[model samples]
Target: MTDAELPEDLARLWRRPTGSGSRLGRPAGLDVERVVRTAVAMADAHGLAGVTLPKIGETLGVTGMSLYRYVGSKDELLILMGDSAFAVEYIDAGAAGSWNEGLQRWARGLWRAYQEHRWLADLPTSSPPRGPNAMAWMDAGLRAMRPLPLDRMTKVGILTLVSGYVNTSARMAQQLEQGWRQSGGVDPALAAQRYGREMARLVTPDRYPDAAELFSSGTFDTAAAPATATPVDPAEANFIFGLEVLIRGIEATTASAALDTH
Candidate 1:
């Protein structure tokens, strides 16, 4: 479906209480879950900076104070919502063939989660994830890497790298997607055409024979094809590149330890 017909990403973030108790002194059917659900939708629509309990309540047709009966302060709701979003994702430990594959899967899953809840990246890093759902996702990542030869510190390092990759990549992708959407979606092919035209007029074909030939070969067209906010895994290639260097370093360290022992 076109963007016009697509489902509102905001619906999952907030909704009004279903019954009449909202008119009473107490929120009749409201609870923390409903509050969080609504808050997520509001944030999804307007960004994390936009979601205040009062604003959420207004969206829900309830007074802001009434929401406190179920959810604590706005800070409390944010913690719960971040953890809840993390809770919905889990790694399939059995599906992958090795630690690297498992790590890649874990990275991809977390990436998808962040994309779905773009505000997730904005979750207060100071809190450090106390909620059960958040801890569970952390545990799942640990479990996926449990069989690797790496020690606890290495596990932490690898997971850190994976998490960093997901968060950083998703944030970049989100920014690009948002900017493109705001500009009616950039065309990758148009980028290639623009580059080719600009270069042909500036550089002499004789002086830059190799560059000119490369441009003429249409390789830029192929490379730019997936640059239009495609969700394809450029990460796989990047991960493989980084992994090779990391693995080689680890092996060198391991070999030195073996030699020292011998």
Candidate 2:
């Protein structure tokens, strides 16, 4: 195909060139998947900034400039990497039994995916997803919500909400975990005690009565806090709580829509 006629991301992902002449001078052994995979490994090891075309080429035992023959640009490579990284098996919503169950499974699966590939949360969001795997994931979520009495836009909105939540939560957790590790891996109880003492000194009851109450309640005492009252891992607990709230909102909205139609 001519440069102007080159297929976009989705089409480019699956389309094969017509002949050896279409190789764009790419090395005989190099192909698109290997190029994308090499970039992914580089990014996983050293973040997005480390994934230069040169580095990818070096990793694959080729000159870095030659990588351009296979992948057009760094931006395009990133899009491919993200699509490849998140390519998941389609979730069987039928097996999930109910809309709620299906959506819950879908959301949790997405959460797990973000956790497993924390770098995904760092990807640039300048454009909407258009890659094959990205579309497949979107299709899976829509299928999960198919039984609901909701419009197409509403279903898309729900998927957006869930994806945003998962990405933000995963990013925050990854940052916090990195910070914790950087701080010499301090004992959680000791860190909590020090944090409580600092807060008590800085936040007096006269200036912050609510803060004082929380401090006095020993809510910051990681070891002493009741399991039933607070999660052992607050980050994870927050994600679960937020996901449930989103699901409930979807259910309520769909139920209301159904009633209005009757």
Candidate 3:
């Protein structure tokens, strides 16, 4: 089924906070589930901007200040929201195959996850993945590649490449989707034409001759690509381009590691 039609169980997952042991982190009666649920629904309807502690309070029939009692500020809520939305439940107990194959599957699943929840792309990578969900995801990724004969540093490098690609591609797709919806379903060709016009106005051939000629020829189709198409397909050309880069980077890393060992 499409992500929009994801089962309630799956969708509500984003609202569930990580366990705080037997001791309650806050007052005895905070309904984290309700807060997250309301926030997720709001985000689905109005992008990330729609999510506010007060707005969520309204959704749950509580005052805005009531929310701060359970969660901290909006930033803290966002951290929780991000974790809930992107949390990992189970690292495939049945994961099977060569380490590289396993890694590729993990990466692809992450890419799909971001696609399913477009907001994942919107979440900033300000610091390393600290939230429980993100950490769980990172731990799973390292576990998947645990069989590889590489040092911790190499593993970190690989993680960087994979994570960067996922974040960049998913976000680009989100922006494109937002624009499409905002423009009331813009024409792909016309949108490209407009971008070309804008570039023409901003870009001068004398300074950027090659860029001007490239856009002027209309051979380079930015509108058809991820940057403009709201919710563009993850299987688009750029996605593939990124995948190729990941594969090549992996191959290169493996070779380099082998050489270092030898």
TM-score of each: 0.67, 0.85, 0.70
Candidate 3 is scored at a TM of: 0.70
As a whole number from 0 to 100, the lDDT of residue 163 in candidate 1 is 76
lDDT of 3 by residue, 1-262 (tens): 5545654333333443333234334445556655776787687677787787778877677788877655656766666677777747424545657776666666776776776666767766556666567777777778878987887877877888887887787778767867877998877666777788789778888999989887777654654555654675434557767776777778787878789888
lDDT (Cα, tens digit) per residue for candidate 2, span 1-262: 5634646444446544523236555667778888988887777788878878877777888998777667667777878888888857534445778888888888787777776666889988867767777878888888877888778988898888888988898898888778878989976556777788778778888989998887776677754454685547666777898889988987888888899999
In candidate 1, what are the lDDT values of residues 1-262, reduced to their tens digit? 3434433222222322332234456666766677888888888788899988788889788988887666546776777677667654444546777655666667667766786788887776654445566566677777776666657877677667667666776666666667667877666457556777677667666899888877777676677566556575554445446655655564566567658777
Model 3: runs farther than 4 Å from truth?
A: 1-29, 89-96, 181-184, 189-237
> Which prediction has the highest TM-score against the true structure?
2
lDDT of each: 0.66, 0.76, 0.69
List candidate 1 stretches off by more than 4 Å: 1-25, 192-219, 225-262
Q: Which 10-residue window of candidate 3 scores lowest in summed lDDT?
A: 16-25
- Clashes by residue pair, model 1: 13-37, 13-38, 13-40, 13-41, 14-38
